[model samples]
Target: MTDDTLEDFYDAIQDLGHPVLTAEELARALDCSQEEADRRLSELAGVGLVGRRDVERDPVVWYPKEWDQQARRERVVTFPNRREFVVSHPEQFTRARLSTFAHLIDTNGSGDALYRIREEDVWGAPYDDLADLLLALRRVTGERHESLEEWITRQWKRARQFVLRTHEDGYTVLEADSESLMGNVARQVLGEDQLHAPISDTESWVREGSEGEIKRLLYDEGYPVRDARDLDTGDPLEIELSLELREYQREWVERFTKQKAGVLVGPPGSGKTVAGMGAMAAVGGETLVLVPSRELAAQWRESLLESTSLSAAEIGEYHGGKKEIRPVTIATYQTAGMERHRRLFDERRWGLIIYDEAHHIPSPVFRRSADLQSKHRLGLSATPVRESDDEVEIFTLIGPPIGTDWSALFEAGYVMEPDVEIRYVPWRNEAAESEYASAVGHERRQVAASNPAKLDEIRRLLEAHAGEKTLIFVDWIDQGEAYAEDLEIPFLSGQTRYAKRERLLSEFRHGTREVLLVSRVGDEGIDLPAATVAIVASGLGGSRRQGSQRAGRTMRPVGGAQVYMLATRGTEEEEFVRDQLRHLQRKGVNVIEADAETA
Candidate 1:
């Protein structure tokens, strides 16, 4: 137990020239019982100072630390503690990083600075051919090699990779490194047998959402587990609200305060900003608000200054033209993902991250923003559903959604009453019809989506709704500009200057402009609470989501809402309305065949 005793034992062992000792023999030599000698051996081995053999009985020989090298070279080694090490020292490790997408592991001894293995190189091919390929690769790279499987297995372990699986639905098994609590839960809950071996040994498992839930439970039960990945606990959000929260908004803030993660989905104009700010106040630390666009970022800055006690001085903007990082920063998802902004995010200590229109963060470029460290992450969106990679990322990066719908908010008098209509206009233009029939795929869909026949319906809808502040969504910018020009109304598109778009939106909101033409840019996160009627003149190609988002423009609590979706029948345009508008129909939207109204 004493350092002197261990030193004497080491000297005696080497002096004996055959230091291996049975418990009884060692006990007699040390003038003690066999138990005492065994205890000494156990204590020495505990710190990796010795190795023991002959387990069946007490007659065991203890070897010094010199044998470890031999053991490693001759054994199937596994690093069970790799997960802990990687998490604590993420900087030191690289998961098979290359120019392309990174795999979780690199073949350590694969000689080349970049060690890569493709599926085509290793899988479903002849074993001889695979071996030859690996041998050749190793020879060229000058890496000492072994059996192909062994080399790959070594890389796999180093990668610390695992897949999270679900049984009921077809969800892609996310290939992630088990360097955080997220990864650990997937591995531990999926299969105990697989966990016992090197993680590479159990490359796949059948799991469910409940497995992820268990990790949350473990955290609640006081298990020492990390809840987030690569996040800094930013400044405590100093929440100063200018207005009081409604009952439901208060409930949302409460839930987020407790969990410190997850999404809040409420109908548009349901005061999600207030709820998010309330969460910030609850956390009371430095914060970063990420939005889908520069406009949304400005909107967040304005709302923060207007509603909360936080001043413009405290709030910073990270966007296309402006790059200021203060205690509370507002940034576009695009800007936040850029290399410089990413460094700023990583360098700063952030307590809270609130995503306005959180669904956007799940996109390919935007998802990288999730890698920014934060103590709390909150995503706000009316509909958080996505048909892309972000769908899964939303669940993992933030948490599940805590939401209320249009009807729920409507019942509470928090949102405007909605009037939904589908205006199916006949495709009467033979020339356009011929062009569409002759075209295929995206070209055909584009032709159908921007059909000239929809122009007549647009005119009729403007006539019918003539005076109400109106927002018209067009499928293409050229069409939007033409419609704006024809009607003498301003058009807003991606090319519209920020100041001009803001002025146009202001004029529309204040009744100076009766009608405004807009491209797809207005489909998300832009607030036009005053507009009661929206004419969806044309929509993105077959995207129900785009249609749904455009409809969201006016569904907020302002009363007397009428939404018109213009669709050209007997073409791919009709399919866009049908496929994209199905969910709206299911939600009690009064979809009518409105050729009569047009006539």
Candidate 2:
């Protein structure tokens, strides 16, 4: 295969949406002979533009030992088209586009002008020229916008009439109509034609072309673009193009890059994963990201590959299902524990270690993380503390918590702020309540918490939120199984097989299965952005950390969400609810309760 054919093969795979293609398929697509296709595929693979996997011996295949299966040697091939493009054109795009307008204003005008422009205006710029200039200015000096024209208009209108009276006996009144001056500026400068004309044509073209390009880019990159917005300054903003790093995320990354290790705490959907990815990018080294579950590990791997120039081969997964190790590895915490425990310090030098869902780090994992002598460590989680105060070990071993308040994220609209409604469902009979009370011990409490009575409430909640993706959190496996059986929906627990769990999670993510009953395993790391409702059927004792983590399972900032915490009135469950709120207090989460009717 010539170099041109190899390049054509890569481009063809990309244009075809990066589908996995065999040599014959590639040959047919490229209108070449099978032998030519094979040669080009080999050459492409040599340059790392494509990946090849032997399919004949795939353990996933049925009748793997069959004679026919042995006779038919096949290879599954995939092209890293997106990664190649990004690697070849890193200067063309960035995860975080610099604020060109703010930069220019700061460089050319007073710092006050930069401050005067609202974040909306700064982010909403429609002209590329303006955006580029602003970004350039910001690159030279740090500045940000705080207010927009609408804010200025409102302030001007409010200050339109000013009364003044002379101190003398005869009062001289003076009144100035600020509205007229503001109106003139509004008409002459801020008018629709004036403010928008500069970018009207260019913005329209960008809107039309960039959308298709972004969609194609994201699809070729193997991820979905959730939403994209165009700034008024003509800069197109694509969330899929880059993860938005929160202020705390930026600070944590900066600090962690300097220190050996540190913990990051924020509520769920507060951008922990975004921060971790950004930190990895900032470090510019071979980073390893460890999540808590296989599903989460895959999700993170996909997200990183899609959002950055990183290749599938560059990102590795070491979980129950996947056994691959690359420079940028993403593995389940459990799997990571096995690898770290098996290897000596001298075996590998991990430039950076990123722990997602850091709060779930078990005692052994905490010890292992502490023992690692990586150059940098970043612990990420919406909830960083365990129910037990033993979290001090994590802090001491991992590092300090460099985090911001969770409410701020809600205020910033970075995450959904739940309107929690507590419904006190009374026990059907005193006998049931007595039985529940009898099971007050630690182990029994979990079983009692998921009693049959709570199942009825869960059914009602599911019925009420039908058609919407809801995550039901139960305390015990039996309860999850019962719920799954009764509702005929997928259930996930510790006993779930790795491949089945991945399938179930994929269905849930794609809106195929709208409701899922899960054990405590769903409390961390997994990304269920489509889930907008959560039913806390049962919970462990008053561990607010658990409650918050469970709540965060559905707190992804997307569509509106409603969270319900069903508790049996006048029972231990009620006390557990109260205790959980107290735990959230430490993380600066304010639990506002409303009536059941409101729920």
Candidate 3:
């Protein structure tokens, strides 16, 4: 049989939605004689491609050996126009191949996978050329898709059309593939703010302090700039990791070293910080780490001391509480971008700058930190999404996303996949309903989010979980305090003092405090202990990143991680909660919904 016949056989099975076929059925499918179909089946069986089985009182049947057992359990479906694929029970090979040119968006415990192809995915494909990416795509999808392939090829070319290079006079210049692109796209989009003057028809002298803006603007216009300018490596400071890196972490470090900038995106326990340290070790230069809060700044200092061959004196904390500039310093975004404190960072050259919780980098106030010049930039975030949908700026200003598939980590037992469920609780009384209904705008949402009946539901869940380590997340501080008082647990919020916050977090880590009421502050920044159960009693309105971060608090190597999202039923809160967890569902988390009374 020719290869076309073999491919037809597989296609027939998919069209039939089964694995087995008799000689008569095969003959009809192949448009050949029954005896010829039987001959082809025998030939395929001899080659171990198909298997033949005889029933007691029926004709012998033929089936592809590979699909005989997995026909119902494993399958791949594609949507070319949407550039998305869904795979059920995907094998390791399928995932590994897809990872080359696709981004894993969702998965579940049963190994159901959802992946989408984006321009960035194609631009940053880990291959030498388009042929390798196309081969991988064909292998994963079982065939080539002309439209999708054409789009990917165009994106691959766009990724290489623009380059930022260092001019001989020690200035940055933007180079385009053609004069038309430089003049029509780069110059018109960049204006005089980012471009000083045109050196050549295809080259423009870049303004001294507008590199980030230029990259961001070009990227918004569907062109990602390759930053290849000669940059300072800062003061030479020997650094080495005291611990070993996992295989994936080593790969991430290698990719960052080659690209010189990227965001390390992974689940909470996938060791992104460790990988950042690995990149620092690879770069071997002075470092600056920017975090979202003072607590995270302190945590970075501790992580560096524990994982790297660095002494306390060599590492500094430059937050509000402490101000010291050492070989390696950790500062909060607010302080680092301040006009007065900005000069402190400007005077010193940094070999590498690591942005912790980098999703904050795209905001107006925080974006100034992205302007800081460094030879290499590394960003760390569990979820790089934002409410404004400006997450593209995160990649444009920092670098492309680089990480392993979440399902792979879950399957390897490196991180536990949480069982997420959303429970809808009803109002406790008509008065409560009346108050919520009478409210207006934000007040309406606040009333719905703080429904009184949730307290009873929370108590019931606590009783069910018993002594397991748990966390209760709330959006409002008052609600958090109320929950804390009723449950007799400490409420950890932004209002909590630094000393008390540290003590509470330390107690939780050591199991002294089994349960704590956490506010928005715990959504990111401070490292909360891994718990067996996580409950979101109230959450910020429909933020996907917040939902993921809250669920990630329970994701660790240990099993039995459960996450419960509570929303006020018969109100807008239901929609908000659903929208919040939509991202997790796309990532393959099975989100079950139920009424509070039944749950």
Best-fitting candidate, scored by lDDT: 3
lDDT of 3: 0.87
Please count the clashing residue pairs in each candidate, in the order shown: 21, 19, 6
**Candidate 2 deviant stretches above 4 angstroms:** 1-248, 258-260, 338-341, 360-362, 437-447, 585-599
lDDT of 2 by residue, 1-599 (tens): 45676566656667666445566766777888978877777766666555566676431111112334333332211112210111111111111222212211111111111112333223223233344534543343334323333342343333223222222343222222354522343223223322222222112112221222322232232222222221111111112236566665786677566544567766777777777777777767677677766777778878887777777767778777877767776766665556553363225566677877677654665344444435566787665556565664454444545654554455567777675666677665567767776774675566457556676777777778889888888877877787888888788887898779888889998878888888887876567777889888887464667888777776776667787888766666677787775545433344555433222
Could you list the CA RMSD of all candidates, in the order they appear? 27.0, 25.4, 6.7
Ranking of candidates on TM-score, top first: 3, 1, 2
Best candidate, TM-score = 3
TM-score of model 1 relative to the true fold? 0.62
Off by over 4 Å in 3: 1-68, 72-82, 105-110, 138-147
Residue lDDT tens for model 3, 441-509: 999999988998999999999999989999999889889888888889999989998899999999988
lDDT values of the candidates?
0.63, 0.56, 0.87
Cα error, residue 569 of model 3, in Å, equals: 2.0
Residue pairs clashing in model 3 are 106-586, 106-587, 106-588, 107-587, 107-588, 108-588
TM-score of each: 0.62, 0.56, 0.87
